[model samples]
Target: MGKKLLVLGASGNTGQHLVKQALERDHHVTALVRDPAKIEIKHDKLSVEKCDVFNKEEMRPHLENAEVVLSCLGFPLQRKEPVPYYLQVAQVLSETMHEFGKRRVVFMHSWYTHPESRARCRGFFLKNFFLPYVIGQSLNGMRLSEEYLDSTDHLDYTCIQPAHLLDGPVTDKKFILNETDSCIADAAQEINRADVARYMLDVIDDESSYRKIRAIGVGVDVTDKAILTDDNHSYVPNCPIRISRADVARYMLDVIDDEGSYRKIRAMGIEGDDSYMAVIMEQIDEFKKVIFRN
Candidate 1:
């Protein structure tokens, strides 16, 4: 049987995939978005609600029947206002869920939010320059949110951290899972938003992943894929480490009822497999055709 799911940030890049994929798997989903029009799909099992996540009163009614809460909340690249937005959302969700006796929660975070990630940043360019200057505020908010979640004992929370996000298609490649002090190589610094969503859903009910932070990236080598550089594929960047958003959604739905993923931080990266890259390229090529209308 499909679980009742309450999805926060349902209009964002990843949330859209999550909502669509969940419905495809027969799960009843209540998607909370700031703008209802942004959700293009209409299904009887899907409920689109327009409400601020920080508003507990507005969110209380939605929590009544939800078996699980999935947060795909994100901030703009240069957003500085609402100083600690992620933390505030975490607090609101925690309070509301506790009030309604809901226990399972999954959050989408970043690899940079992990404590060991600082060392993985390596050199001055990333550690000193990029992180602090390029995405400083957003990173700070994620870190704070992570810390707050870590301190909470009542909520069964799992934070899935993905490295640089890509808008690629799902390759169905097997992911390599790791935890604690695993350094994601430069080649593995990217994963499709879809795959991250997959990991989040997979571990949803798994007790092994509860209260844990999982970091993910794609580590495949696609040096020989010619389709990546083809002229018709301008949007799909010529990169080897590609995973799709659709696949991510597929993964999440697969594990929403499993018990091994609860309270665990499972950091994931794609295994180095050339065959997988070949298949991924084919999907990307097809995806490109659809985008270019060729």
Candidate 2:
């Protein structure tokens, strides 16, 4: 049974994965973008619509046709606006969905939105400076959007929050999920955008996930050598610094692929650079030993 979904921000990094994966699963997707030309894929099941997402009238027709709404909207880092680009879209979507009696909606948010999660950052630089300086406006917008969603009791909404996003293909390992505010994986700071999309679709219709905030990260364990320290001068142990965008897509699909994952945040990632380097060193050492022994 393929459901009809309306995806906002379909041209974005994560949005692209959502649109593609939904088609792979046989779901009919109406990708709403400012520029339909940005969508490169042409599929019978996928319809690209060009429209202003901030206008309720413009979104009404699409909202009426959708069984689920997935928003992967993001703001550019360099944008100097005090508010995020997606805040208005969020408002419009919420209003339109309610007017049309649509209940299922899922939003893509960052783990930084959680105060407790932000406080958990390993060092002074990341906690006190870097994150705030770089993405503070985007964070504020997401937080405000979440707050707006929370005020509405009629919409069955789930906000998928992931750690730092990475770009890459899906990995062999599964992503981890947590229902709480904090990510369950130790020192896990990044996830694939694809996995985030996968998780959103997976729980789109699950009743348990409705009105819940889920935090996700990649499942790969970070060993000691790979852990990096921040300005606080403390080693952040077992941290996989990033995950691939493809893996994020895979995790999102896996969640949709399985019913049990409903209402849980799925963390997706691969091994960090330091961990990979360590493995390479071990291999070289083994090769040296073999040559000397011979």
Candidate 3:
């Protein structure tokens, strides 16, 4: 009971996960990449095709009998691609799919592409400088891509807008899709790339998600609970250390023990704000001063 899948941008980070995951699910996957060597996956059920995604005629043959089309196309935040390339890709894909009578399509986007989501972004530095300047140019392309998809006909399209991407394994952190203009998650929200792939694949077979534009947020269903010890005594530290779980996690793994971090505190967010990112700069500064002081 496996379906045929055509994946665009198969060489990219999130696209690689989608390609691999689809194969794991026993789907016959055809990955179209600019460079076939970039895919690095070989399976009897998988086929790799090298083509410019903007060329509809070249892509038409690959779309033949494809039950699902998943596109994880977009450049990095630090770099910008050429003008209206996102729009061009979507347009080409749209026409090609229509010609081949293929309909199910998934286009990757970001929550920041949504106006409301961008507005809701809390930090002044993030909103005023980082987002508007560093990340804004690329985000504009994603928005245009979504718009192009919206204009297409005879397609069961789902534009998936993921929150800020974090590098990690496929997490158990649950993902939710909201069909509104609001930000999918709070300003502090960060999702693993693999989880974003998981959700995209999840919606492929789901008929209910067709024709919907949704923003995806990770860890919304997670709850914080204190684990009780065997003894009836709560282990209380000498001083109450209040730090956001995420802020502490930023220093987790090798980051905490790295020599580079020994006497320094990674300043994260500000205090007394309505943002999900609470004051961690002050706490971390004090912790370093007290523990690593000369």
Candidate 4:
């Protein structure tokens, strides 16, 4: 049976995919949004709850039937909204979940938030500048939100960290899962928002992921199969690659269970420094196999 869900930030880029994919998988979803119109998709199994996270009364009723909570809440980079929205949402959700006795919660975070983990910010410009400068303001809230999530004792929470998100189709590359410390390789690593959402919902029923932080990134194995260069050239096949939303959504919903993923902060990506053209060669072999089989 599909689980009931209370999804915050369902209107955002990644949240939309969560909503869509969850419903597609027949999970009952109650999307908590400030405006119902923001949710462009509609389905019989999906319900849109109009409420602000700050309004406890308005939000309480939506929490009544939900078995799990998924939060992708965060403000846009262009607007630095005061009031520490991440922290506030964390507090509210914590209280609400405790009140309803719901335990499992999945949160959207970033690869940059846990620098102390295995993730290393490669490149001098990214480490010395972009990490600290371009996203400094937003990082504060992510850091605080993570602290709150980690400190809370009542909920079984998982903070999902994905590298840069881009719009594209999903590919055949398997997501590289690692501990928070080991998952991220470069500041340039990117994945699709759909892929992130796919992963978040895929683990909704996973009792093992409780109280863990996970980082998801593109794998070095499939980089060449999908990425195109500036001149429409495919980059040398073995580079770290970006993923597609369609592929992510498909994979997450289709993934089978694995006990190794339980209660651990797993990083998903390829290992080593130079991953050139290997993915291309693999794909060619796969194509050849298909042709020969026919």
Candidate 5:
């Protein structure tokens, strides 16, 4: 069934794709943005609403009778203090979701935020000297957003994670979903914004994706030894439970192509290893047996 959906960040790299895709599908679409003048989508089905996400009251009106909410919030990478901004947006969304009785939410997060997956890279100079501040800020913000999702026990929500979101073109491959993240994946992973938008819409259209916080990474098309050659996979490691086998196989394929990640695993526990890979695969391997045993 097609229901009304709201996108928090309507004017972004990924958000534009999302808006266009939704409109093309004939879904009831509302692009909630901070600036109304910048609305560029051209569809009779698309409705643009201007509101500051920082204000709860300003955002609630847009959530009226909404079935799903997608937030591609354009959070910057440089901030002296950012946890407040993170929590504030989440709080506003939570309040708005509550007031409007919206039961579902789908948001985005980075790959490393999972505390388990190593699906991307930052290089030596970046990780050691620069990206930490931004990554740390994002983590802080995601923590609050994630906490709200967790605490909102009443909403059917899923947090979508993309691995090293690159502005490159989209590639159709496998998705990595970690079931029991005892350790991070042993491969390299990268995803295109278009792919992320496509996946987000897929999740919204189907209730199967509700109530789960997921991390997504794009992989090259590969043959899954477990399944025959004519099926699509859907597995996503570094995600919460409640996934399927088809997804598992798909995720497996992505990991298979992840070279940068594999090297990090061997170097996961080295003391002097600060190759960005070492700290990147920094999540504890609490889910190894469960993930690989079956």
Candidate 6:
């Protein structure tokens, strides 16, 4: 059966792609965007609602009874101060989802503010001059937002923390997912926004993806079928994943469970530094057959 969803930040770069795909897949989509008429999504399966996320009352009607919610919201890049808007929206959304008994959420986040994990891929500049400015001027509110979510026991949430996002063409390569750092690699890695949408939806109902955070890399297609394992550490390479492999594999039977690394591996059909992440979940399903076959 097709499920219904309330997608926040539908006007955003990633959210736009996600909303389109959801409608294409025949899911009933309610887009809570700041502007209703401004959205170019011309799908019959889609509906748009105008909302200011900070206004909890205004957004409540939109959030009510939605099966799942994906938050693709963020602050502008030029801002030299804290991003209070994001924190307010996230906190309210969390409570709203909890109150409505709709706990599924996939949140977009950056690795900069997530000091808890080691995915901090330091660029030459961020490590040098920009770090102080970033911490002092930009990162505080996001970190607080994360802290709020961390403390919120209300909903089942998943936060996707991405590395330095550089704009480039999609390589149609596969994207990797694991709490482990082993998958991290190459080319000023930024996930194709479309691909991030793909992962968010596919994993939305998977129990393992609930309350889980994944750090991914810009990927290249790997058809060799070689499975790499990083036993050195779990989730983020150095930082251990709180869960075990038995749990991850059980949640999404299609993925290859690398207990050695405690990370989930799947090919997004994207190959190269720039990736389209378009192959869908075909590769992972094939691996599942090999691994889980009796």
Give the number of the best model, judged by lDDT: 2
lDDT of 5 by residue, 120-204 (tens): 3434433443334445556657756776677876678777877656676655655666433311243234578888888888887
Any runs in candidate 4 off by more than 4 Å, and if so which? Answer: 78-83, 115-119, 170-172, 186-188, 221-294
Cα deviation of 91, candidate 6, in Å: 1.4
lDDT of 2 at 137: 57
Q: Write the per-residue lDDT of candidate 1 for residues 1-294, one digit (tens) a residue.
A: 889999998898888878887887788999999899999999999999889888889989988788999999987554333238889999998998898898899988777765456766854455765565556557778878878888988889987777767777655756655556333653366778777777767787799888876666666554322332222433233243444444444445655886765654443223334444564555455444433442
**Which of the two candidates, 3 or 6, achieves a greater TM-score against the reference?**
3
Model 1: ten consecutive residues of lowest lDDT: 224-233
Ranking by lDDT: 2, 1, 3, 4, 5, 6
Q: Which ten residues in a row have the lowest lDDT in candidate 3?
A: 227-236
Each candidate structure's TM-score, on Cα atoms with residue i matched to residue i, is 0.72, 0.73, 0.73, 0.71, 0.67, 0.66
lDDT winner between candidates 2 and 5: 2
Which of the two candidates, 4 or 5, achieves a greater lDDT against the reference?
A: 4
Model 5 stretches with alpha carbons more than 4 Å out = 79-82, 115-127, 179-188, 205-208, 221-294
Tens-place lDDT digits, model 6, residues 20-127 = 778767789988887786688787778888888888788788778588888888764322556676678788898776767767788877655654343354444344
Candidate 2 stretches greater than 4 Å from native: 78-84, 182-187, 222-294
lDDT of 3 by residue, 1-294 (tens): 888999988899999998888989999999988889888888999999898888877887888768899999875443344237777888887888888788899988877776556887865656665566556656777787777777777889998888767677887766666887636544336678888888988899888888888888864432243311112223222222223455445435535466755655344321323323232354334334433434
What's the CA RMSD of model 4 in angstroms? 14.5
Candidate 3, position 167, lDDT: 71
List, residue by residue over 250-281, the lDDT tens digit for candidate 2: 55565576766665453434446545345445
C-alpha lDDT (0 to 100) for residue 134 of candidate 1: 50
lDDT per model vs. reference: 0.72, 0.73, 0.72, 0.70, 0.62, 0.62
How much does candidate 5 score in TM-score? 0.67
What overall lDDT, based on C-alpha atoms, would model 3 receive against the true structure?
Answer: 0.72
